[model samples]
Target: MPDKDRSQRVSDAVHHRRWLILTILLFSLFVVVLDNSILNVALKTIAAPPPTGIGASQSELEWAINSYTLVFAGLLFTAGLVGDRVGRKGTLLCGMVVFGLGSLLSAFSGSPGQLIGFRTVMGLGGAFVMPATLAIIMNVFERAEQPKALGIWSGAVGLAIAVGPITGGLLLEHFWWGSVFLVNVPIVITAVIAMVLVVPDSRDPHPGRLDPLGVLLSMGGLVLLVYGIIKGGQLASFGSPLVWATMLGGLLVLGLFVRHELRVENPALDMRYFLDPRFSAAICAVGLAFFALMGVTFFMVFYLQSVLGHSPLQAGLLLLPLAAAQMFFSPRARLVVDRLGTRVVCGGGLFLVGLTFLGFLSLDTASDPWLLCLLFFCQGVAMAHVMPPATVCIMSNLPRSKAGSGAAVNNIFRQVGGAMGVAILGSLLSTSYRHGIEGHLRVVPRSQRDTAGESVTATLAVAQRLGPAGRALVQPAKDAFVHAMHVTAVGAGLAAFLGAAVVLAFLPGRGRGPCADDDRATPGSPPATGRDEPDL
Candidate 1:
C-alpha cells in the first residue's frame, strides 16, 4: 500500500470513532458529576441502617462527598502526565476498570469509613480519566473543530452538575441507599465497552520521562493545601498547630515543585505555563468562577430542603430548571463566544450571576416557585457562557505537547475552588442560620415556646395541635430561614463581584489590536502587542 493510503486509513478510523468515543467520554464525565451530588441525597438513608449511625452529624456526612473530589484534585496532575506517556486508550480503559470496582466497593460498604475508602479509589480513577478526556478530545478533533466539540463536552458536564442533585433525590426516594453507587455500574460498563471499541489510541510522541519526585511533591502539596482549606473553618477560632504546619508545608512543597519543574529535564508538570498571560488569566478565572458557582449550588440544596420545608426529592426537582435551561442553551454557547469573545461573554455571565443571587436573597416562603425557577434559569444562562469558552481559551493557549498537563492543572484549580466554596459558604450559612434561629426563638412568646423545638413538619402538625398559637410560631421559623437565605445570597453576590472584578482587570478587553478576535492556537507565534506570556 502507498504511504498516503495508509495515512488515509488511519484518518478514516479516527473520524468514524470520534463520535462514539465522545459518547463514552461524556458518560464517564457524567459519572463524576452525578456522584459528586448523588450521595448527598442518600446521606440520610446511609445513616439510617443502625442505632449509632442513625443520626450522623453534618460534618460526618459532608465528608462522603468531599473526600472524592479532594482526592481527585490531588491526583489529577500526576495522572495526566502518566496517561500521556502511556497510551491514552490503555489509561482510559484502566481508569474505567478501577472506577467500576470502586463503585461496586462503595455499594457494598458497611460503614462510612469503608465507603470513603472506596470513594478515594474512585477519585484515582477520575484523575486518570479527566485529563485523558480533554487531551483525547483535542487530539481526535481537528483544531478548527475542537472549540465546538469542547463546547458540547462542557455543556454535558454542566448539565450533569445541575441535574445530579435532582437525579440523586429521585433515586433515593424510590431506591435503597446503595442504589446511588449501583447506578454508575451500568453506565460505566457501557462506556468501557464503547470506548475500547471506538476510541483511537494516542500518545505524546516525545513524552517526558516520569518524575516520581514531582508526583510526590504535587500530591503531598495538594493534599495538605486542600485539606487545610476544607478544615479552615474548624481551625479558624483555635488556630491549631497542625493547621499552620500543613498549610505552610503545602506551600513549601508547591514552591519546591515549581523550582524542580523549571530545572528538571522532563518535569511531571512544566511550571512554565504560568508565564503565559492567556493561560494564567484562564486558570485564575477557572478558580474564581467555581468559587462563586459551586458556593451558590451548595447552599441552594440546603435552602430548598432545610429552609423551605421541601423534601430531598422536591428540592432536587426544583433545581431541574437550572440544568434544563443550561442544556437548552449549551449548544449555542460557543457561537456566542465566537461572536462576542471570552472576555465579554464571561464578564456578562458574572454580572448575571450577581443579579440572580440578589433574586435569591429576596425569596420568602410565600414567594412564587416560578420566581425561584427564573433565578436559577438566569444562572444557567450565565454558566453556558462562562464554562465552555473559558475552557477552550485555556486549552487552546497551550502547546500541543502539554495538553494533558494543561487540562489537569485547569481541572485542579476548579476542584480547589469548589472545595473552598463549600467550606466558606457552608460555614457562613451554618453560623448565620444558627444565630438567626436562636434570635427568632427568643422573641417567641412563652405560649409557643415548647413547640419551637419541633421539626418543621412537627411544627406544622401542631399548627392544628396548638391552634392559632402554634400557627403564629410557624411564621417565626419561616422568617428565620428567609433571613439566613438573605445572608447566603449576599455572600454569593459579593463573591461574584470579586470574581468578575478579576476577569475585567486581567482578561484582555474586547476589541484589542492583534488579539481582538483571535482564537488561533498557533505554536511558536508571537503574542499580540509583542508581549510574551510564558510557554506551557
Candidate 2:
C-alpha cells in the first residue's frame, strides 16, 4: 500500500473510535463530579447525632469537604506531567483503580479522621483522572469540533452535579452514610473497563525529564498556602504570628517556585501560557466562578438541612433546579460565545451570577423556598456560560503537546478557588454568627453557651438535649445564621462582579489578533509559537 493510503486508513480508524472514547471519558468525568457534589448531602448525616450519625464537629465537616480538593489541587501538576510521560489511558486506568480502592475504604471508615485520610487518597486518584480526560479530548478532536465537544463535556459536569445530590439523598434515605462512598465502586469499575477497551493511548513524543524540585515546591506551596488561609479565617486573627508566618512563607515559596520554573529546562508548567491574555482571563474566570459557587454551596446545603429543617431528600430535591438550568444552558453556550464573543458571554455570565447572589441577600427564614430555587436556577445558567467558554478559551490557547499541563492548570485554579472560597466565606459566616448571637448567648448557662455558639448543628443538638431550657437558644441561633448568610452572599456577589470587570478589561475580543490553532500530533512536530504579551 502507498504511504498516503496507509495514513488515511489510520486517520479513519482514529476518527471512528473518537466518539466512543469520548463516551467512556464522559462517564469517568461524571463519576468524579458526582462524588464531589454528593458529599454535600451526606455531610449532615455523617455529622449529626444518633445511631444514624457520627457526631463530628463543624471543623471536621469542613475538613471532610476541603481535604479532597486541597490534595487534588496540589498533586494535579505532578499527575499531568506523569500522564504526558507515560500514556494518558494507562494513567487514567491507574487513577480509577486507586479511586475505587479509596472509596471502598472510605465506606468503612470509623471516624472523621479516617474518612478525611481516605478522601485524600481519592484526591490523589482524581489528580490523574481529571487532566487526562481534557487532554485526551484536545488530542482526539479537531479544532473545528472542539467548542462543541467542550460544551458536551461541560454539560456532563452539570448532569453529574444534578444527579449526585439526588442519588446521595436517596441512599441516605434508604441506607447508611457510608453508602455514598460505596456507590462509586461499581461506576468506577464500569468506567475503567470501557476506557481500557476503547480509548486510544496517547503521550508526548518528547515528554522530557520530570521536574522533581518544581513538583515539590508547588505541592508544598499550595498546601501551606491553603492551610494558612483556612487557619487565618478560623482563628479570626491575621495578627497571629503563626498565621502571618505560614501565609508569608507559603507566598515566598510560591514566588521561588515561579523563579525556578523559569530557569529550568523542563518546567512542570510552562509559565509562558500566562502571557496569553485569553489564557489568563479564562483561568481567572474559572477560579472566580468556582470561588462563588463553592462558597454558596458550602452554606446552602447546611441552610436547607439545619435551618429549614428539611429532610435530606427534600433538600436534594430543592437543589434540582440548579442542575436543570446548567444542563439546559451549557450545551448552548458555544452558540452564545460565537454570536456575542467570549468577552460578552463570560462577562454577562459573571454579571448574572452576581445578580443572583445579590438576590440571595433578600432571603430570610420566612422567605419562600422556591425563591432560593429560582436564584439557584439563574446561577446555574450563569455558570454554564462561564465554564464552557472559559474551558474553550484556555484549551485553545495551548499547544496540543502541553494539553496535560494545560488541563491541570485549568482544574488547579478551580479547585484552589473552591477550597479558598469555602475557607474564606465559611469563616465570614462563622464570625458573623458568633457575633450576632453573643449577647443572647450570654443569657444561657456558660457551659451551654459555648457549645451552642459552636455551630447551628450543635445549637440544635443542645436545644434538643436540654428540652425547654435550650429552646430559647434556637430562635437566636437561627436568626444569627440567616444574618451571616446574607452578609456572605453580598460579599460573593461583589467578587463575581469584580471578576466580570477584570475579564472585560483584559480578555481579547473575537477576531482581534492572531490565534494559535490546536496542534495536531505528528511525529517530530515543531514547538508552537505565538505573539507574546508585553513584559510586566
Top lDDT hit = 2
The CA lDDT at 17 in model 2 is 72
TM-score of each: 0.86, 0.93
Model 1, C-alpha of 43: deviation from truth (Å): 2.4
In order of listing, the candidates' clash counts read: 2, 0
Q: How close to the true structure is residue 67 of candidate 1, measured as C-alpha lDDT?
A: 77
What value does the lDDT take at residue 431 in candidate 1?
Answer: 55
**Span of 10 residues, lowest total lDDT, candidate 1:** 527-536
Task: List candidate 1 stretches off by more than 4 Å.
Answer: 1-10, 49-55, 233-240, 439-478, 508-536
- lDDT per residue (tens digit) for residues 327-356 in model 2: 888879988877778888888999999999
Give me the runs in candidate 2 sitting further than 4 Å from their true place. 1-10, 236-239, 513-536
lDDT of 1 by residue, 1-536 (tens): 24444332236566566677677788888887778777766665665645423343445566677678778899888877876777666777788788888998988777778887888888888888888888778666655566778877877877888677777777777776777888889988989988876777666656657789888999999988877776764332215677667778888999998988778887786566566666676677777778777877776765676557677788777777788777777667767766776677777777777778888877887777788888888888887777776787778776545667777887998899888777676666655655555554544556764444333332344454666655565666666657766886788777776766766666654555222123333433333221111111
- Name the weakest run of 10 consecutive residues (lDDT summed) in model 2: 527-536
